[model samples]
Target chain A: MSGLTPREWLGLEATHNPHRWYLPVIPRLSVREIFLFGGAGLAAATTALEETTERPVVWATAQYLDFAKVGETMDLDVHVSVSGRYTTQARVIGRVGDREIITVNAALGRRELDLTETWPTPPDVRSPDACRPRGYDYDQDSLGKHLDQRFAPTTGKKLGGPTGHGPGRLCVWTKPPDGVGNSAATLAVFGDFVPMGISNVASQPVGSNSLDNTLRIIDVRPSEWYLLDIEAGGIANGFGHGQLRIWDDQGNLQAIASQSVVVRDRLKR
Target chain B: MSGLTPREWLGLEATHNPHRWYLPVIPRLSVREIFLFGGAGLAAATTALEETTERPVVWATAQYLDFAKVGETMDLDVHVSVSGRYTTQARVIGRVGDREIITVNAALGRRELDLTETWPTPPDVRSPDACRPRGYDYDQDSLGKHLDQRFAPTTGKKLGGPTGHGPGRLCVWTKPPDGVGNSAATLAVFGDFVPMGISNVASQPVGSNSLDNTLRIIDVRPSEWYLLDIEAGGIANGFGHGQLRIWDDQGNLQAIASQSVVVRDRLKR
Candidate 1:
């Protein structure tokens, strides 16, 4: 966390051209050492866009098209479609060699306005220190190992565990080793938990592949631990949809994200 | 509805090339007779992508960058990034001349799976016929004129009315002149109600312009009147965020949409 930019933390390298960036898919940036994690890919693209535009991201949506393996590299090309006085519309297309892997569309910039209010209250839960550590089946070489997660008391089931019929809601306190210090890219990485919540709601160890991930920023503040309040909207026809409200320790809403995933049974994997 | 496809219904004219489409922004396709409606623009893009890919839309997201005023023609260019056996990844870049107005990225196709489930249930409300007709203050030359809207009994307030501080939820029954016949594009048009819901939650006659609209289709069935259950997420820094769950008369979830908008005082307009 020593004044390191998110691009440096994610091992994203800058080219001589301002609109181009690349990330080597190291083990820490991948999922189970198999492919680039969806959130990590999104974070890489976000960092690249922010660096090129020199603006804070307001909203970004990334669609996962293919996979970049652990040893491959993802090259991102930034395109600025419109640059307004107060906002900019841009996109980043990431590819490994000639094969496209991800496409991220985003808006970045801020307007000076007086109004500010948040209505959704955070769930009353114990602090991260009081919660039990979350358990996962993946090895240490995956992206999940880089995050420290704790299940709230309201979380009806543990990861890869059974659950009873309920409202399909899960609350978890997550923290990275270096902390999310006012970086939207860091929060984007944590926003990938919707798939975990989907499995909890299904009452089975279900595996999901995200087709799209959208992050809507309300406000980003430096915080050590953030709460991920995940709720499953619905699951139908082999697809699952859900949303998460990320909150700082003081109960301030940081960002809201929603995603749709392709659901499959874990046994098949 | 006749034998009209969604492209035909939206007046999207196809060019000799398969990847090109255009829409003349008529009053019925605009808002306030001033600019193209955000959802209509998205629906136009979705229609173009579907027509080009020859597939059903699973999810589509559009980022509104600029305005396409009434009487203007929007030209859409469809790009298929990946055409898999069961799913296709594509995007539509829409513009009025050289000004980019909207960008829509989508995934389309369906898979045969033995599993199907929907966790979120529709709210218990009276039939559409039992509700009072919704009132609006706009003229006849707008998209709102084509929609028949009814205030649900659970709705605490009407459009442009005062409201008590609550959870910021509004339910309404809306029907187009022609029913939504398994068309995701038609449902995309209805997904633009987040701004209206924002005004209701604020208890003021506020105005909002959409920045991004994301639609995730779960199941679509033909129905006369569809229920729009809108919930306001939060408002901060002159930006409003909200989501909606669209349901048919039979209580089946048709789609879920989330949006972010720039908030303004209606008095200024």
Candidate 2:
């Protein structure tokens, strides 16, 4: 069965410069069907560098400046700022025409050492079998359509949970389509769900436009399901800040993700 | 008496190119009087751009590539990646000669909005007055001398503390010299102390050399004392990951910072 490659999902194309790439903003990878979601752009940039340097991205932080609407193309220019024996620090600029949309800086490399520990134990929640699936319907109106989501018992309560009102935490079991594979880039895409928590906790239709998304990749292992543990911390001055922990099905901490978003109160509008 | 301006402390010199500034690595700013501390570089880069753009840095992340020693100088090249009416996204590269030492990406601007909230409450720890002062002495061998650190009651238990032997959390009240004003740049410096928590929680003498430090500025209020609530999480594959929340004395969440570090065991050596 032939299907689209992960690169195709990202709409990444090769450029004359090996360090640079061209990516298209397609609906399949967009959040609101209007612009490229923060995660998709992060995935494309890191994936391109992962393929180029043949190293895993240890940490990458992308500061989103503007948006690339569906049908727009972004030119990703990657630069290896410094190359060391065990690590390489790099930067990528994603632009559409003369307008820059996203700028990402990353550290890529792997070293072998004998220290390992994961602090937060996964909360004992019902398995995906017991949870309700969300955002799986292939709808152009929502970015959730691209992933399979099962709301854990702790998921935003007002939206249909064992509900709560204040900014607390949410947990969900989610996974991309089977074709995406297990990679740091995939982790980046899944790690962009903190905004969902913001809306969920608000219990009202609130919109959040992320100013920046930072992902720190801890470990990448093959797993069909990943759990998102999101904590919505503070909201002030029309902005919200939160942190998310991405864990595989086996409860292994894979990455720590954080974001700050510009809040849009739909009720006010 | 007129003190040296913030720019003078940063030693930022004007370049023929308006977009570029030169910075010197001085002992007063060095962590151990050798190489430039992570926070100093971050401060210099952001201060330079803050002066040029006449805006405050909202978020800045720096990936440490190499060290700029006490006599060496770095050229900070700033670029305005995107400029919006109320915000500007920019990147800065700090290089010594042809070698890149630090790369920083930041968001700068101030907007008027009516939403405000701070979630994380300050942990009930001993005040700086009740806690023991650390790194207060001007010691050339330690980074502590640069800041006044008062270990909260939860500080290292095993490395001669109340004695615990597992990865845990540490909280401290820390502040830069009185001469340094409280700005986002000052927060950046205080947020670079995860390495201390690593050593505190490890029990033994271990060193965590950070690969990158990312600071998400939440609020930059003028305060003499800032609290660092650091959680030292996973340690594996010879690396460690941790997150810190910066709070002002009034229990306001100022910034969320995280880092990944290369772990070194002095016992093994």
Candidate 3:
């Protein structure tokens, strides 16, 4: 689409044995690539040597690595030590200009059993189309092209956006095209979505940088639409905490994410 | 301590369910206050609870219920339900301002014995007093006040008092001032130390805000000093990720902590 070959548009940071992948922190592609890579890895791991995918694969636990500029290529290789019965593990490397920008270790697994008694009831709320987007315009610097955010309520809406005097929850739909598979590529994609916990909610007109992002995939139910139920609270000084639960179309809880939040407005020394 | 005594600090939300707590958001506290509440709860959960606590209390997902403000005294309560052989579940509530500020469902567990394995080798490292702290000054906002962050570098230099950077791995000594015993109250205190995973490293000078903190009590080795080999990667687009494997002074892997990080600067934004 960018008038370049697949290899030219995005390069794979791959190598053999002691498998390795390298990706750049390009401003334009770094974040999206990481999500796609992570998500793809997980998808790849789940289905085995399955069919090549073309549809937008739905996945979760997308965290930001580093920013790749307008023209940097990222490399993603898989280090599958053990693709075990119930689970598997993969390590990722993201690089830019000889710098390994991000490295991730992700655990891949299939939905083996049902925890009906323990899990929370899915929120009986609005559809993705009903919710309006907020954080995208918070600050231009905080927004990314790769993220297609759709929130029913906009930033100015004082109430009903999840936190209004009501239930501080917001429903968000993030579309990272390459982040919906089970391969190392899938893991790389999903790992970049961790910031959506805030990006989809409070950070509009303001954005904060994250120090670390971690995701644990509880179940694997891949889909075309990745949904996030993001919420935040308990802000004392300036930092607080929040969580994101990713569900597929069937409304099954696929993965859950949590992170320490640094409210950008309060942290500017 | 107020005119209401325990009743003064007590208030339930409209969504309050006797079997479960639904918290409204607290608007007074800044982001920092939420962080303090989370850290305090971690310490309280880790050190206070006896048999019903999550082994390592790996923070799975922490969702902010509503807007929480500062200066208000927040009350947090935890109910342990079903302590399974491998998994333990708990209901947590955070309250303030005539409302429950937040509620969470936490799952604590030990490594499933179905897949027995070996812990990693203790890095050839130094003693706690050997390294300097890598983070910035500790204030009421940091988890450090609740922890004793003493480092002994086996491979890297002493961290430069909180904000400096070092190796991918390091060793440190941590202990809750009030020991976590075999009691429910103690579980509250045990989890406060899990955030040290990033503060001990010398990469970015960002304060930590935990979204969801999870820990697995490895051995529960009785000791005055614990060893933590913290490693984290997957830092893309400003968001990062990390994990820590804690060992008793005896080199036993006593616990494992993994957290998703939001990178806000020290003073907080």
Which whole-number lDDT from 0 to 100 does residue A234 have in model 1? 73
Score each candidate by Cα lDDT.
0.83, 0.77, 0.42
Cα-based TM-score, every candidate = 0.92, 0.89, 0.41
For residues B150-220, write the lDDT of model 1, one tens digit per residue.
76764333332222224677777888756335588778988999887888777556778888999999887
Top-scoring candidate (DockQ)? 1
Q: Write the per-residue lDDT of candidate 3 for residues A1-269, one digit (tens) a residue.
A: 12332222234333453344443333334333333333332332222211112212111222234444545545544444335443333444445566443444443334222112112334554455676554443332321455555653333445554433223466566554443332333333344343444443443332444323445444444565556666443222233345455666567655555453333442333
Show the lowest summed lDDT stretch of 10 residues, model 2 chain B: B157-166
The fnat of each candidate, in order, is 0.58, 0.54, 0.00
Which is the winner by lDDT between candidate 1 and candidate 2? 1
Model 3: per-residue Cα lDDT over B178-241, one tens digit each: 3332221222333333345554443545554444445434344466666666654333223334
> What is the DockQ ranking, best to worst?
1, 2, 3
Highest TM-score, which number? 1
Q: Which ten residues in a row have the lowest lDDT in candidate 1 chain A?
A: A156-165
DockQ, all models: 0.63, 0.53, 0.02
Candidate 2: stretches off by over 4 Å: A1-5, A8-11, A15-17, A135-142, A155-166, A202-205, B1-5, B13-18, B135-143, B154-167, B203-205
| Sequence-dependent TM-score of model 1 | 0.92
Ranking by lDDT: 1, 2, 3
Per-model C-alpha RMSD: 3.2, 3.8, 23.2
- The lDDT leader among the candidates is 1
